[model samples]
Target: MFSDLDEQLASTLRHRAGGDIDPTPIVTRARARGRRLALRRRGLIAGGVAAACVALTSVVLAIPGIRGTDDRVVPATALLLPQAQSGAPVRPGEVGADPATVHFSTDPLVSDAEYATWRSGRGIESVEFRGPSGGSRFALARTEVLLNELQQTLSSAGRPQPRSDVRVGDRPGVAWFDRSGDRQLWFVRWQPAAGLWAQLDTYATSRDEAAGTASRVRFDGAHRCVVPFRLGSLPPGGRLLECSVTFGRSAPGSFIEGALVVGDDSGRWLTVRAQVAPNGSEARRGDLVAGPYRARRQGSDVLEMVVMPCVVEAFRKGWGDGYTEAEGLAILGGYQPAADLDRPDTW
Candidate 1:
């Protein structure tokens, strides 16, 4: 209890001094923040302008045939069969007028099996046969011109398949055994005629059964290869490889209808095929593959498709650069088959 309040007065003065502090540092920091924000906003606007220019350029370049002069690759139709690209194109036919025809069978080549479907290529034809066991290829040919080619291709040449010399009746032949998982596949090739050869293949069956099936192939028919649709000319230096269709009196819902395979001098191949819509096979729906195909299938090299009630798919079979989807569709435009595609009478 001192008479005068000196300590209290000193405390009060200290508080008043602290309350009246300098505001210069805070003001300076706020000014610096404002400048930074303004710079950032300007950068954002410039970046957006640059991005817009790039997008505009890309959109201009994306049009199909907008390249400089003849730099674009448009779908061109021409007929050049096993000839040089520089050669003059031949006259376009109302249909695939390929002179090369394979020997064909009107009846089932295998006696016990039923003839289901068939396909003909440049110089060859193969028929599909089905029975209680499964399906197989039992092909009979009338001419010998394509026998050597058949032997070479079916034999697989350099990287060869294991084979054995077999005799179907008095006709000497060879057999190839392909092992896939738990099943064994058999292909027996025999000289049915003096100059010509025939093939009998089993999907999966005993070797004895395969040999017996091979001996039963009937070789008495003169059927010619006639195309269903008008061919839209081939690519330069392209040759027809195979033409396919589904045929059967019993099976109402055929698997596939029309296909055309074109090959270049370099051995690259392209296939365009139109198939039945609502096919029972899950494999045949989206991508139309080129194979012996009665079951599951994977896609070819490059595939593109469209739905026209009948599904159409085309693919070039190699990793290298090749034709575009537009080009493939143009090629397929030549393959619209007749309504009675499954009937031999119409074929």
Candidate 2:
């Protein structure tokens, strides 16, 4: 009996000393419990934020500028901190306004898809004026773009003709013409400001016409509106990287399509667009419903939300970015039209 007691006591001491304890399972269980606690904490925080948004939205909707029609409740995004920074206001001779009402090619020279790809690569801003045959292309550029025009022309397959220093009104600039197949390409590069320049291009056109068109470009930088929508509750660590907003032109002027883009630190993006659809076309393609909004998942990473003429799209980086289906709905629910739809937008 004494020997049996000694054996039992020795076993107890070994057990107490953790000699037989399997630490791997204990560590794993502890880790799992910690993860659960963390998830619960995050859920509570999100819930609190959602409640606050609801309370704030009530007060925001009452504001006169943000009031919406009966069918559309104003979006709740107007009350958030601004993510867009103001830039220099549009001055005279900006790319949008031109003194001469010159006609451009009616045919599209570059497809929208092609332009989007090229523009993204160049990191430049431009406007595409589409016509029946071909459209004109205008861009705001730096002086280096002007200086390198000759080299860029030579690099192309087109045979470059004589290059000349020309004057557009009071400003001196460079002009060059190139022959490619049956088309004659005219390019006029001129300075609109001390450090800023503008490039105008046309096919089968004249240097004078291009220069005249370039002179009339006007930009008004004042009066940009904020994106009225934000993520109702942002994904963890989400932050704004870049944003662009444009307002559609009112009637009596050519229909100007508008767009908004918001990029985040998560390598994701949100885009909003307002454009005319052909009569008798369907607007809502999304079957998923977020309140009154219709939303749909496009492919694996994109969430598309349709609001009548305007379509908003959100992109995800990866699963860890936390932009789940529920989060996507919350973002769509946060959208509201800007109070000043007629005002100039930050692009």
Candidate 3:
């Protein structure tokens, strides 16, 4: 009866047969085809369910603080420094690295030069790292200058209260918080070496962030010396004992003025100082020779120094009787061209 029957015929005969079908190869084949179609439909539905589960899993993983147990937000990229190790444990006195070499974990709020200039006028060499907002400013300064400033700050207001002993990395440090009127200041200081110290100051950031930033600071070496400018040649047996560079603007242009005090074993001292004006033209400040330097006698004992064009010349003369005029002249004559003494690194 089903010899020439198509799918429509098979369906009609199966329905007409009520509850039973004759035991034949054609009926058996038709039943098997129905089962295969049902399996295919179930497979498609299963595939769709599996795809939805995968998509939901992906979304859950992408949501913040949900996919895994770890709650900390891992930074995608870290700020890099030329001489810093990433994610290294830092300790006090472990590395007397220059503050300039310190790399914060976050992007800087200001340029390096601007940070340098900001501290130049304050009589200290410091590198500042700011948080994403205006209220977060952190600074690292040399130990000597930092300590001096701390002492001054404390003494100015009776006696400053100390927070507690703090450690950054392996370095032991101290902390202090000050609130005066409308301003609040927080400070953390640590020693990186026998004679070197590092400081972190925060204005508007949380203490934790400041501490974390301080701990993140690391250097690749034992120490890095970053000077504002390079020195030419010193007088014979003349050892540099003290120096300070100040950054400021002049009518002609930006200028840097500083004093370099040097002394020898003879108990003699020579003070060399010059204010460089960035006029890019010749300038004559006084009656000293005006080629690249001019010298004038302020008094019988003091010699005023000046520079011209773009040459680095020693301009000041405060010498004891032990060192002779010829020696001073020799010290000034060995003037290095402007290449050696560039603007302050911060400038």
Candidate 4:
């Protein structure tokens, strides 16, 4: 499935790069590939569920067999899954597996050839995504958001923020002290068709704490590393149909919130919350998943609608002082009205 998507992506990139390319063919290929992938994943999940059901049935039947053991001895173990012991108490931390430890960086400019060369030396695998606004300016808007957050954090901590330098991957980027007094470094590089950003931070705490934080950063980085672009240009007569939002706050006072909006024919718009996790995972609670709703025609336009209170609360907690009216509109896919959508002041 990934191979097929990669081919479609390559074809689309060719068209976007102006090599006498047409996108219709690529889009067709991608749609087909996506369908197949989804089906395959669903099948796997179904199979697992079915197996668990069968195992449960076997155990149930075995209970009757145990009563007749004097007449015909039957082993109870034969009727159960390997892990099912009738009298054993389950232990904590033995159910779900321990989370993996990993680290992630947040610099967005690691696409220069020089930076790529450096990363290759460091045994890191990197991939690039091409965007519409030329390679240099692609995702600049999202990067600006990150930069703003970094600046705010630095100022709050009374740390010196340096002028961001464009450097090759091999060279160490900028350095700054974080809110917790950790030293942070950043690097940038360019790739053939995309750019790269790399960041490294070292805390004064123990290795275990640092590793845990790094794991969180890695998860957060994975989510934040992607370039944000409109899925498609807004179609004529398109109207906003629905909006979903989410917000979450970590124990450490970090927070994140996000929203997704859908229009009748305007594709989708996404607004991401700004709290960075060490592992680059999606915000735990402030995630909104919407859609599968019917669109309605409003004159020449189409519309859909969704209202989720839990998701909005997550955003409220995460946005804190940084939230603004304009940002709220973007978060709600440009449809949420000032009066209809609840705000903190109103609450």
Which candidate number would show the highest TM-score if scored against the true structure? 1
Off-target runs (Cα >4 Å) in candidate 4 are: 1-151, 161-171, 178-194, 200-257, 261-347
Clashes of 3: 9
lDDT measured at residue 78 in model 1 versus the true structure, 0 to 100? 7
Candidate 3 structure quality by residue, lDDT tens digits, 226-345: 232434656667765544333211111122333445566777766554443222224434465533556544434444444443223332322244555555555555444343333222
* Candidate 3: residue 185 Cα off by (Å): 2.5
Task: Give the per-residue lDDT digits (tens) of candidate 4, residues 1-347.
Answer: 23224334654666574643334234433433343344346446665211101111122222322221112223322221121222332222221111111112222322211101000101122222111211111111112223233212111244434544333223423434334334332222122112233333333233333323222222122111111112232234433232211111111110112222223333332222211122211233222222221122112211212332112211212112233333333333433322322222111
Report residue 128 deviation for candidate 3 (angstroms): 7.4
Better of 1 and 3 by TM-score: 1
- lDDT of candidate 2 over 1-347, digit per residue (tens): 21123224444544684553323223222322333344346446665211101101111122222222112233322221122233354433332232111111111233211111011102234444322233345656444554354222111235667878878778898888776456666777777667566676666467777677666654333222234344444445643332333211111111122333434555655444333222222454667876567777655655666553334555543212445667666666666644433332311
Sorted on TM-score, best first, the list reads 1, 2, 3, 4
Clashes of each: 0, 21, 9, 39
In candidate 2, residue 143 scores what lDDT? 44
Lowest lDDT 10-residue stretch of candidate 4: 113-122
- At residue 304, candidate 3 shows an lDDT of 41
lDDT for position 149 in model 4: 30
Tens-digit lDDT string for candidate 1 (1-347): 01012223333544664533223222222322332343345446654211100000111112222121113221100000011112222211211234233243323233333224445655456655543345566554445455444432111112326778887877888887765445666888887666455777675466666677677654442333433443455667766767654422111222324566777777666766554333222334443322312111223344434333344546554222366554454455455445443332343
Quality of model 4 by C-alpha lDDT: 0.25
Worst 10 residues of 3 by lDDT: 51-60
- Extract clashing residue pairs from model 1: none
- Name the regions of candidate 2 deviating beyond 4 angstroms: 1-125, 142-163, 179-182, 219-257, 265-268, 274-294, 315-330, 338-347
- Comparing 2 and 3 by lDDT, which wins? 2
